[model samples]
Target: MAISKHIIITSLFISLLLLHPLVQAIDQEMTSNNRGGSSFAPKMNCGVACEARCRLSSRQNLCKRACGTCCSRCNCVPPGTSGNQELCPCYYTMTTHGGRRKCP
Candidate 1:
């Protein structure tokens, strides 16, 4: 019983040791990615951005919801109510579950 318990602890320790380098690599990559600025992204004012994005929509509420979702994820919105997707690639590439374009 003691030997089995020792073996279990030894196995656990080895597993953690193997995982340590992988965890460190991920941490280093994230740290380097953020070295240019804050580690946490500044939150977007989705309400105002979305409001502007949706201002000219015929379906205002639906437009706001879609614009808000894209703004939240991309932290950006193209400057107008229409067709300037080149400004935000993340927002431009997003799609709905059914493969329809997601961002307004």
Candidate 2:
């Protein structure tokens, strides 16, 4: 009976570890190609940790400023530019729809 109980506990522990979202979140975060660099963390910059993860608001001055600096390093096209603005969505859509193609 004790052996069975220990096996149950061990299996439950391993199952919970596998189920934890943090595992995947951390993996995704580490692999992120965001070019703000490893120096900037959304956690440290957000003032407090958010219960759920979210992207920084593009409307915020900080995000806009950061994006202006960082977007060139990312695969994304700049949000506003003459002529290219219209093409940006199609580019993004195709890229997303196909899944992780090399940036132009």
* The best candidate in terms of lDDT: 1
lDDT measured at residue 8 in model 1 versus the true structure, 0 to 100: 100
My TM-score estimates for the predictions, one after another, are 0.64, 0.23
Tens-place lDDT per residue, model 2, 1-92, is: 99999999999999999888878897787777465455453323221211111134434554344333333343344333222433445333
How far is 56's C-alpha from truth in model 1 (Å)?
0.7
Candidate 1 stretches with Cα past 4 Å from truth are 1-31, 35-39
Task: Tell me the TM-score of model 1.
Answer: 0.64
Candidate 1 overall Cα lDDT vs. reference? 0.90
